[model samples]
Target: MVSSFRHHRRGFFSTLLLLLAVAGCATFVSNISVDVIRHPSNPSSSLPAFHEAPAFRNGDECSSSSATGRVDIVMTLDANYLRGTMAAILSILQHTSCPKSVTFHFLAARPEPEVLANICTAFPYLDF
Candidate 1:
C-alpha cells in the first residue's frame, strides 16, 4: 500500500513537471515599465491589475551583483493566470536565499505589452 501511494505521488509530480515544461520557454525580457492600460481584447490575453510586490534584495552574505549566482525561471505569461504567476514568483523571492539572483522569462502566445508593463511595475528590480 505504501509503495502504491509513493508510485501515485511520483506520477502526479512527473505530470506536473511535464505540464510546466510544455508551457514553452521565453528569452529574457527587457526592463520596460509603464502603467497597465487595459484595452478591449480577448479575455484570455486581457491584462489584469496587480499591486507591486516589494523589491527583494540579496542578503549581506550574497554577491552584490545579481549576475553572480543567477537562476532563470521560465513560465507562460497568460493574463488569465497572471495573478497566480505573480504569487508564485513572489513566493520564490520571499523564500530564496538571494532573491536578486533570480530572473524570469515569460512566454506569451501574442505580443502583450501590458504584460511586460505589469511585470515591470510589480517587480521593478526583476531581471526579466
Candidate 2:
C-alpha cells in the first residue's frame, strides 16, 4: 500500500508539472499586428447596369409601390472581406425578385471611407 501511494504521488506531480508547463507556454503568445490595404474606388460606369426590379404585391391586398418600399438587409463590411461582401451583395441582387426594393446597411469596426466609396461605386443604385 505504501509503494502504491508513492507511485500515485509521483504520477500526480508529473501531471501537475505538465499542466504548469502547458499553462506557461499558452500565456506567452505574442501580439500580432496586421496591415490592411485600402483600395481606390472603381468607376461606377465600368460596372454593368441592372434594370429596376418589378414591384411586388401582396396576394390579399396591395397597390403599386415605389422602390422606397424596401427590404432592409444589414451586413458588416471590412477591407479584409471586401471581395466576399461584394459577392454576397451580387448574389442577393441576383436571387431577389425585387432587387430595387432591397436596402443594405453596412456596419464596420472602424471608420473606412474607402470601403463605403467602393460599395457605392459597385452598386450605384443601392439605397443604404
Clashing pairs in 2: none
> Which candidate leads the pack in lDDT?
1
Question: Judged by lDDT against the true structure, how good is candidate 1?
Answer: 0.77
lDDT of model 2 at position 9: 100
lDDT, candidate 2, 34-117, per-residue tens? 212222335443222233333332332322475545689999998778767887888888776666667789999999887677
List per-candidate RMSD values in Å.
Answer: 15.1, 9.9
Give lDDT per model, in order: 0.77, 0.67
Clashing pairs in 1: 29-128
Scored by Cα lDDT, where does model 2 land? 0.67
Runs in model 1 deviating more than 4 A are 1-46, 64-67
The regions of model 2 sitting more than 4 angstroms off are: 1-63, 66-69
